[model samples]
Target: MSGHSLENLASFVRDLDSACSALMIEGKNLFAGSHEGVLRCWDSATGDLRWSVEVAGPISGFAVDNNRVYTTASDSLHAIDMSSGELLWSRELEGGSDYVKASNGFVWATSSVYELEVADFIEATIWRFNENGDELERWIITERPWYFDLHKDGGALLGLGRPRCGYLKIQPGEKPSHHQLQTESPVTSGCRSSEDCFLLGHADGTISSIGSDILSDSDSNSLVTDIASLDLELISGHDDGSIRMNGTQHQILGSIDSVTLLDKDGWASSWNGSDTQITILGDTTNTISHNARIRQMHSSDERLVIGDELGRLFFLEAEIVKRRRSEIGELDDDENKNSEIRARLRMLRNR
Candidate 1:
């Protein structure tokens, strides 16, 4: 421990084959889902599994408010009670919906692949639903929706489409508007809000702001896999243990405060982009595998919730630990000699 403490909240884990599509932090409870089509919730303090709700098809999207949780799978949407895990209602549409975002008193979603008896056709539709799970209005678009971020105060919506395909801005009741601030390269991860606009981390290791700042670069491939913003600072974690922070103006500010290891070569952090620099509170790196990548981290500027590709979820605080001596060069004489020879051979392999 680095003389720092984590928020010590509990976390829920869902084992998925590819990646997690939906995560909602409802009060102290965390709701998450996977392609397995199950909604898993856990206590945020002890990592205890509280409840699991099974659904049809794969859970493609989720959004939550004070009293209800809404999720979409295949061609249908479901409404569930947050307290008792009760099914409130479900709506099956002509097509399956994939991405969802919540704002104000309404829930918005986009659907492609309208199901037909003879053949399925791709149709992009955006639906707005009231708080009571009632459809209010619908709009059609030419492009499929990759993801949606809500901007309540700004009265605008940002939608991510196929990689480098750019984004569409939808007003309260208007047709979708296209923006050219996107690349053909895939976006690894992104986060959007009404307050801070939208941020995207690309497959080429570059990070760009979509709404206001149009700055983009191909060489700054920081290999960013996840991104989060708080108090005008952006924090992103890479494939390596490296994390970077940038200001709202899109300038690199600092780095990860620390890195902690989990059991399976994974690491977690609770830093929420509070300070000018990133902070890491606890580490299990010495005991876990180094090949593990922190897939998704959810936190405010104060606490952190992290998950890795291995489906391990942990809650950590934002604090820094002192660097420890690496064990790579600490072998005995005979073993060290053999390791040196192998190391040289490995270097030659890269050439």
Candidate 2:
């Protein structure tokens, strides 16, 4: 490549009409979904739009496994056949979100709900489903969901709630278990830490980690505890660039735009739109910033892809900088444009 210049840029797909939100890479296909109800899969090697499908409503959060794509909209969840672009199944569930994951032979989703039609406080529920689109179970907990993900073994799920940080562990065919952590603030988002524990972003622009042992009760369904459990401790947190506001502010900053775990090693990444900062979760001291406001962060293999509010697509080689980032722990504040730091990154455009 030309030293991270525009020459090595892969390819790009952009639309002035659709606001892109999610990105994924499956095999040689790079996929993106937008608010315009369009979902397209592009060939990673060629940057060609291999296939695209448009549905009735905007696509929020969705996952593709084998030949099926599971998606969630504002009021429903759907299972679609990727090959034919045909709707396989759809369910009417309120509070649909763009946050969905497929693991442990199941598709999982989260949504907010109220006890009554017009209640004030919000409570959220997490649902699990089999690949065939059958709803297995739902776990309703104390607060609105701020974060959710499956454990490493896929045997269990973790959810962190907000207003009051209510944490719960949900396993198939068992009562959801709850755990207490030191964080008592509103949780904005979370992901698995480098150590397999969990990272939770606070409204105050801080990030913290919870030990894996706290999730020990994850698989209560098993007569004997699952071997996936590991003894760990709470990794302290630091200011990850969240700016504190007074009683009144736009309230957009400090919230999580997207989260992805680095594949090569122990690095976990999340984008905070509030201050336009990308934190290497466990190593919160150093962060990255994009020229524009970032709306999503995703990865497949060694490439890290980003989508922004301007309907632009970008791509970077994550593994190239992984070794250097880990060794330095925290990069110097003025190193972003440093020639040595820009070597392995490239952007992809979607026109």
Candidate 3:
């Protein structure tokens, strides 16, 4: 496949003052959070700045619902009106907020503090909140979670470390349940692969699925950084600059930071942190280079939003990229034809 520049094919581009730390795409709105504590909403179609809001610290993560955008910045969680970008409420969380998710009309967040004595995070807390910012319930666990995701049945799935190197399940209005799986390493990334299965990637480059018998070993010793699924096919990114699809590894130029399935046709994007580029994998592989390392990426259908460490935001349409690739292929073919004609003329002169 031929390589093409992403900047030439992007639908629009925007800039921020600091590194872009978080990104969320909902409907026609694009929400971007920066390391300098600024969250801005943009019109995904036209690249117009709809609104911008400031928080207390660097934005850690974001979760969006029908009417509100939930954000975790430093040790606080802030709720902002989705339409107006107004600060609805803010609440301080114990330890520090690391991840947040929203499902079934409720918001969930996790926080943890590192202990110098133990050289690790000893305790972690999970908080559940209503739309009005009222805390409905909270749970405390012995070890901090290394990964968190929403369960298929509107609960929280937490992958832990150390003493309890398994998973914890938290349902609404119920006690937390711990399930210790027989594994060689801690879970680093996970996602819902199907209606009845949850795929978890391990630090030792193994993949395990809950409620299913699917197990895969990528054979690479590097940590699995991210996992995504398209139908029954599992795609995983590794720290060794490789991406595995059902145990088939494809090596790229740099360590993989994240991997996400773009559509039903098995189109996927894997971010290469060392090269500061995104490799789109499908029938033909193409790369999109960036000015700085990508911090976050989110996609909806054919549209993609990328945020970089230099605080630049790029909105891309997959259709445009496909067209660009075709053009580059045509150009290469023409060059080859021209070279062949020149060679024939030189042979005639020599004869």
Pick the winner on lDDT between candidates 1 and 2.
1
Global CA lDDT computed for model 3: 0.78
The weakest ten consecutive residues by lDDT in model 1 span 2-11
Clashes of each: 21, 10, 0
Q: Model 2, 122-181: lDDT tens per residue? A: 666678888887888987766776667677656454545455464677777889877766
Candidate 2 deviant stretches above 4 angstroms: 1-11, 14-16, 114-121, 152-156, 194-196, 204-206, 212-292, 318-351
Best by TM-score: 3
Q: For residue 80, what is the lDDT in candidate 3?
A: 93
> Order the candidates by TM-score, highest first — what do you get?
3, 2, 1
lDDT of 3 by residue, 144-163 (tens): 88778787778889988767
Ranking by lDDT: 3, 1, 2
Off by over 4 Å in 1: 1-21, 46-50, 93-96, 114-123, 154-156, 162-164, 182-188, 193-196, 202-206, 214-225, 236-296, 308-312, 319-351
TM-score of each predicted structure versus truth: 0.63, 0.64, 0.86
